[model samples]
Target chain A: GAGVSQSPSNKVTEKGKDVELRCDPISGHTALYWYRQSLGQGLEFLIYFQGNSAPDKSGLPSDRFSAERTGGSVSTLTIQRTQQEDSAVYLCASSFAGGNSPLHFGNGTRLTVT
Target chain B: LAKTTQPISMDSYEGQEVNITCSHNNIATNDYITWYQQFPSQGPRFIIQGYKTKVTNEVASLFIPADRKSSTLSLPRVSLSDTAVYYCLVGDEPISSGSARQLTFGSGTQLTVLP
Candidate 1:
């Protein structure tokens, strides 16, 4: 793809339900990231994947939140037993292998848990 | 990771020049400064990045001092479409870093361009 692509631009789910957000990064990019933004809040880093290394999961708020990147291209963020506080926009970004490369971001998935 | 601080909000008129400054008092040697702009309901878009001195692109210019304690993003002529939240980020090896290493975003500065 030309840029980072996310699926299901908007999602409305009930509390305790599970929701999945998908991201497809640009071809040949080796780094991907996930972030969450609540209403009128700053973006909170969730996870990061670089090439074939283990993903950085320190930013995941709780055990209910998990993510996986397959084939070093597409990634999915899964939120289990969603709560009202989980309502936010989930953003995905990708960049080249080096640290100096700028990140390309997707429009993101807006998840609303009622 | 280097923590950044920016204003909560700023106001500017159309066609005027706007400058937003970010402070990173404890930036490390390997850290690089980057800026991003985001509109309501949209993900952040990369604006510019610089390590020191000045860097200019078609969109904006980034200025970093010798001390590296702070940086500035300058927009030549602002327009209503330029109204957005601008974020400043600092980190080392954004790629190739192991787990627990990544760029962190602050609240960012909200720039409003008025008529």
Candidate 2:
């Protein structure tokens, strides 16, 4: 099966504007994750979703950042009133969430807030 | 989750075997070490994983000492294409309770393969 897929390989928006990043996890994968990678930095955990279980939002940086996984498959990450600091590569990953399966990641959407 | 520390960067010449070590001094008994590789503009790709002793795949080899506090990723005969950032992560594999956790990556080590 194909790996995780994320749309809008690149996105540019004004600092005060809002933006949405989408992720389509691998078919049949029960767990999904979103991470942020700033230039020359490590991957920062953002949010995670596991089946019908409540999504974990503890990693989200601020109220302006939110995410939702619809139908337990596709997910959308929205950033409101974006700040320049929000500029980074947003990566989406998915796995079986059991037996210590490794995560498969998408190419990611590079968000640049001007 | 255990914290991992790796060298900020390393330089090697093409065709040389490179070994990058990661330190997780506080690793737990249940923790398993995994390594990932990332090229520019691409998401990370899993390389190798191991609990103790040695584990090898077509891509790389993982060596963990009995102490379990550290692990090393060894690239065999690296090439220019092997230049990338390598990350090491230590996580409690999976408990019998069917619980799972997110993987935490450190500021990976950047490997430059020079010709």
Candidate 3:
């Protein structure tokens, strides 16, 4: 794909339900990252994957939040037993395998837990 | 990760120039300074990235000092549509053995271009 793509642009779920957000990175990109932004807040780093291996997962908020990237192209973030405070925009970005490469971001999925 | 600090908000009028500054006192030698602009319901878009003194692109210009402790993003001829949150990010390098690009974002500066 030309740009990063995220699925379910908007999601509304009950407090205890589970939600999954998908992200498809650009073609040939080897680095994928997930970030969360609360209402009127800065972007919070969630996880980072280089190829199919996640080198960093320290930023995941809690045990309920987990993510996996398959084939080094697509990634999924799952939140189990979501809470009301989990309502936010989940942004996905992908970059080439270097430090100088700028990350291209997707439009993000807005999750609302009622 | 190098911590960054920027202004909370800024106000500018149309046709005026806006300059937002970011301070990163603990920036590493290999760290690169990058700026991103985000609108109300969209993802952040890259504005400029600079590693040294200065870099200018079509959209914005980034000015870094000799010490590399602080940088400024210059937006020329601002308009109402230029109102957005600007994030200054440092540390695009690999900190550990197999770390990918790690970007630490602070509360960005909100620039409002008034008509």
Candidate 4:
């Protein structure tokens, strides 16, 4: 089976710009999640989607950060008005269901804000 | 949610058994202890999970005592490639659809497997 995949392995953008990171989960996976990892820091949760249920956005740092999983297969994490602090690796993961299966992660997109 | 405490760093020579302990005094009944291994420039990979007692997998083993307040990740005959950061997380079923399964990752224990 193919593993989860993310696009734009690396991205460099100036401050105040917006960027979109995409993720394609493994087939048949209904639960998708987005996470952020800053240098020398732990993984920070961003948002999550599970089938038709309401998406979980509690972990999202701010209003500027938003994510959407369309058709329950692919997801997009968008950062509005990026800042230097936003420099980090954006990771995506998928699972069979919420709380039932372990998560499978993608290699992630490294975002560098200058 | 429970707060995990672990060593900031540890070093071991190749072919040696490495054990890293994590403390979570406030662990709840629904919370399950999970461990993840992460390398530089990569997302974390799941290692093992356990509720109580002990759980062993092909890659590693997890030992949880009767108290369940703490757990240990034991790696057998660690190699240089095993050098990475290990995170211990405790999470439960979300209360609502809007609740993220977002793991509360601690300042992980960095294991340096030296040859």
Error of 4 at A98 (Å): 4.4
Stretches of candidate 4 exceeding 4 Å from the true structure: A52-54, A98-100, B95-98
Which predicted model would earn the best DockQ?
A: 1
lDDT of 3 by residue, B4-99 (tens): 999999999999999999999999888899999999989899999999899999999999999999999999999999999999999764434455
**Candidate 4 residue lDDT tens string, A6-95:** 999999999999999999999998878888888898888877788634457888888889887778788888999999999999999887
| TM-scores for chain A over all candidates | 0.95, 0.96, 0.97, 0.94
Which residue pairs show collisions in model 2? none
lDDT of 3: 0.92
On DockQ, the stronger of 1 and 4 is 1
- CAPRI rating of model 4: medium
Q: Candidates ranked by lDDT, best first?
A: 3, 1, 2, 4
Give the TM-score of each candidate: 0.96, 0.94, 0.97, 0.94
Stretches of candidate 3 off by over 4 Å are: B95-97, B100-102
Ranking by DockQ, best first? 1, 3, 4, 2
Tell me the docking grade of candidate 1: medium
Cα lDDT tens digits, model 2, B12-115, are 99999999999999998777788999999999998888889999999888989989889999999999999999999887533332333436789999999999
Over B1-115, each residue of candidate 4 has an lDDT whose tens digit, in order, gives 5889999999999999999999999987777899999999887888999899999999999999999999999999999999999999887645432466535678899999998
Docking class of 2: medium
Off by over 4 Å in 2: B93-102
